[model samples]
Target: MDIEMKKYLTLLLSGMSLIGCASSDDLSLKQNILPLQTEVCCESASHFPWFRLQQNQDLDFELNASSPVNQFDGSKSYFSAFTFAQQSGLVEIRLRSLMLDGEVAIPQVELLDSEFNVVKTIDDAFTVKFSDAFAKNRYELTEKVDTVKTPYMIVYVKTSELGKKVVVPHPAKIRAQESGEPMPIVTDPTYLASNNGHFSLSVETITLSGYNQKSLVEAKPEEVAVVQKPAQPAIQAIPETQSYYHNAIRQAVESNNIDKALSLLDEAKALNIEGAQEVFVRAVNAK
Candidate 1:
């Protein structure tokens, strides 16, 4: 080869070697971030607790000072980790933290594959505030993960979300709305965000057959059995009272005292003397 061509090939090989070194350095840095202790907590994917999440079952957990701290991103925070059981399908995860004394945890999730590699990072969880009569107000996060591809998950609060507050309508307003009463104007309550708190996690598996069945059931109108009420016994008229009112109204009408006949009709109607109003109407029509 020419001298110039030889020089160009040498430069290209040097650049390729530098690129390989940089890639190796990045991998090593990632491996070094794994937590040293495996028994106590999950700083690494393989060290995560084996959690057999049943379909539509909720698992309650608490993160306090004793919880394991993760500093994988250069910020110290507590986290909960789990590895799904075999046969887990398309999984829907719901995380909830009740607002206790105006404090709660803001949760973010990371989905990892079986090989301890992160497949997806769900940092932007759409959180919402929920209140119900049976429980205290709480914050909820719902996200779906295909467990067949990503079977591991980690729940944690990012450092940026720490000290943030979630504003929600006051409990008084919610109570008023639920009770169908006039709502009172009150300042909205705020929940202080923290990295450690009490939370519950629920998992639901979705299958095509199950979803189709549910849709069909919902689309079908509910059957309401026609309940025929038994007929009430007829009220027998008191012959004496009925005769007295009828005779009085007819006599007044015959005497050309139409006003008196109408007055008598009103009294009979107040007394519930049946057929009195009909007699008055017939007399008026005839005249």
Candidate 2:
């Protein structure tokens, strides 16, 4: 080979050798600056965590204590999506929705195109649980492969007691529009103690060494508003008694009117009915 070509080959080999010797610290420095696909976990103090896998990465995300799904890790499940570093390749991602005591049966996934067409859907997945009490857990992860498209992808997950559903849209890139608003970024999850009976959804995220994923703090999932029906009034039963005052109070109790019962008791006491005071006090205490 010519002397010039020989030098070029030598330099190329040396550069590869230097990369092979790069440490974890060196890799962190290059993160976001370059899309290197590895297991990126959420730090303990991370408030909002959601990230997109690079084109070179083969979907390597899982939920655990150290690498929790999100801010509300232990008690709630999490869901989020990130843009693919590239614009034209086909990649797949999995959504794992967790529940406490019992496993959630159907974990539906709807993939929509830019025009909002349902391109793919998953109806159900098997329930999984940990054997040990320390596990005290139940989880439902999508077993099917979700085809993630370029330009963007959408993820839908179910969570909480009634299986509240959420829709997440992940765009291909973070373009700072004139309004300076970024869509589908992390949202602060509600804090609640971990319960074996509550279902939770969460997503993990990380910051590349120099890469800033545009996040809008106010962005939240467009969840369906839940309307809570008012609780039915308790039907208070009257105690069987021969005393007139007691009977009057019982009538009020049966009608589920605390105010009427108290009023009747006061009248009975004013009339100097024997034991009226004691009966009234008892009814009020019972209520």
Candidate 3:
């Protein structure tokens, strides 16, 4: 082969090798904690199915979990999450875990100030659960008053077992319950001032595997679109009954007869006409 051809082929092969390695790295697995917006606590393992927080709420303590099956081979890691909003005076928390052995395993919890010094250490029985199974046990830690100026709280756990204590792979997140009842919905500006303050929890989870660059890969085939015949146009038809009801609804809305509009909406919904519910909800919410 010519010298120029040989040099070009060597460069091409090197590029292909790098591309393959990158693709493999992309497919490699990792763990991550999906952060919650508003603060909410995980009431139980059953709640893990679709646990999340609201838009305006925040969390004081949160558990960010990964899929249990995705846990590292021998690394017994702990997740330390923090709250978003600042708080003064006393901050409280309740801890509970799935029983590992015969006795209930008390996970070590520390309340730290802004400088990471241990402000308070808590390991005590504060509440009781009726269930004995790991799934049924409830751990409680309350009345953790700290004098520090930090806005974050850390809850960490590591296994004492020599080997990996293989619990279900999914990481579980929990938060301290709110102290007061939620504020009621207020529609008027004047009435809004009477609404009391509502507190929320903030929890964040970070996955160690997501940081591994070697396992990141980018190997995938680009999509190739194939055009086909367009869909057949259907007849734009309206039944006589529906036409009459639509006209009546339009007239009622124009006349500002809300009851008549609602009654028409109920009839239209029962008929299950296309766009009936959408139009109805729009009318109802408009007022």
Candidate 4:
């Protein structure tokens, strides 16, 4: 072959090899994609089938077109119901949804009593987090529930979250960046808001003993009577007493007299002292 023809063929073969590598990478990603749900809608909340949640065990499920649609706050969306098999003291529940395949599920929770009455509603609690092991992003929410009052919970998508998108670094691009590749292909793939995706829920029982003992103390009848005594007349602070009030609050907090420090704070406010609130907060936080 002539020298010019040989040079042209070499360049053409190199270009084809690059194109083949890119195609292979795209196919590999599609092949390893996680499977999504294809079921129908669940029943209404009152008669909905609830999956039993066991302590310290993780349960995974999906919400799709088959998931039940319910009206909440005047908007319709899909939901899932769950009930604890056994609970005691305070239980911590952790919920997470995977952001995969350009879709994500934004979840809110409603805690219900035995009569199916709403006890507590939780929203805007899920925060985006990354998982290195799975090379994927997830939205996670961790909340403590009092099992005595609320034993049932429902996971649902809020109306406000619909059409919202979560921007995440593409896993393949992240790998390229981490490998120190020059001119690495970088893309911020967005996961669209959806009521369909994979999620996992886990529960852990918390011991009451871990709480502060002072907060659990109840006042006796005699103590209540003592507290009901007439209050002393308020002593107004003189003008230009800002420094005095600040020092007094710091001293009280240093002595572990939180009540006295708060009383000083109220007195300072009554005197229209500017920056008194900031000083009081700083003192308390320092303690």
Candidate number achieving the greatest lDDT relative to the actual structure: 4
The true-structure Cα RMSD of candidate 1 reads 38.0
- Candidates in order, TM-scores: namely 0.52, 0.26, 0.28, 0.52
Q: lDDT by residue for model 1 over 14-62, one digit each (tens)? A: 5545545565335323322222221233345554333444455656775
Please list all clashing residue pairs in model 1, or write none if there are none: none
Q: Which lDDT values do the candidates have, in the order given?
A: 0.57, 0.34, 0.32, 0.59
User: Model 4 misses residue 131 by how many Å?
Assistant: 3.0
Q: lDDT tens string, model 3, 1-287? A: 34653454355445545544553223211111111111222332122111121112323332222111111123332233333123233344334543323223234444555444455545554343433333253344444443223333434332232122223211221111233544444331110110011112223222111122112112111000102221231223235334434544544443344455555556566555466545544433333
Q: Report the C-alpha lDDT of model 4 over 1-287, residue by residue, as the tens digit.
A: 34653454355445545545565335323322211111223234555445555455566666543334556666665567776645344789888888877777788889988677899888877888876774358998889987666767888776576557789776676676789766456677787676556787778878442223212111111100011232342344433245545655665554454555666667667666677767766655554
Clashes of each: 0, 10, 31, 3
lDDT for 143 in candidate 3 is 47
Using TM-score as the measure, the top candidate is: 1
- Name the candidate, 2 or 4, with the larger TM-score value: 4
**Poorest 10 consecutive residues by lDDT, candidate 1:** 216-225
lDDT of 2 by residue, 1-287 (tens): 24653454355445545566776445423321121121222332122222433444323222211111222212233233333332223433444344322223223444444333546554445354432342333444433232233223333323233233222222211232434666545542221112112223232222222233222222111111112221231233222112434644654443344555555555454444566556545444443
After aligning candidate 1 to the native by TM-score, how far in Å is the CA of 274 from where it should be?
A: 95
Sort order, TM-score high to low = 1, 4, 3, 2
Point out where model 3 deviates above 4 Å. 1-76, 98-105, 124-128, 132-135, 147-150, 161-287
The deviation in Å at residue 236 for candidate 3 is: 48
TM-score of 3: 0.28
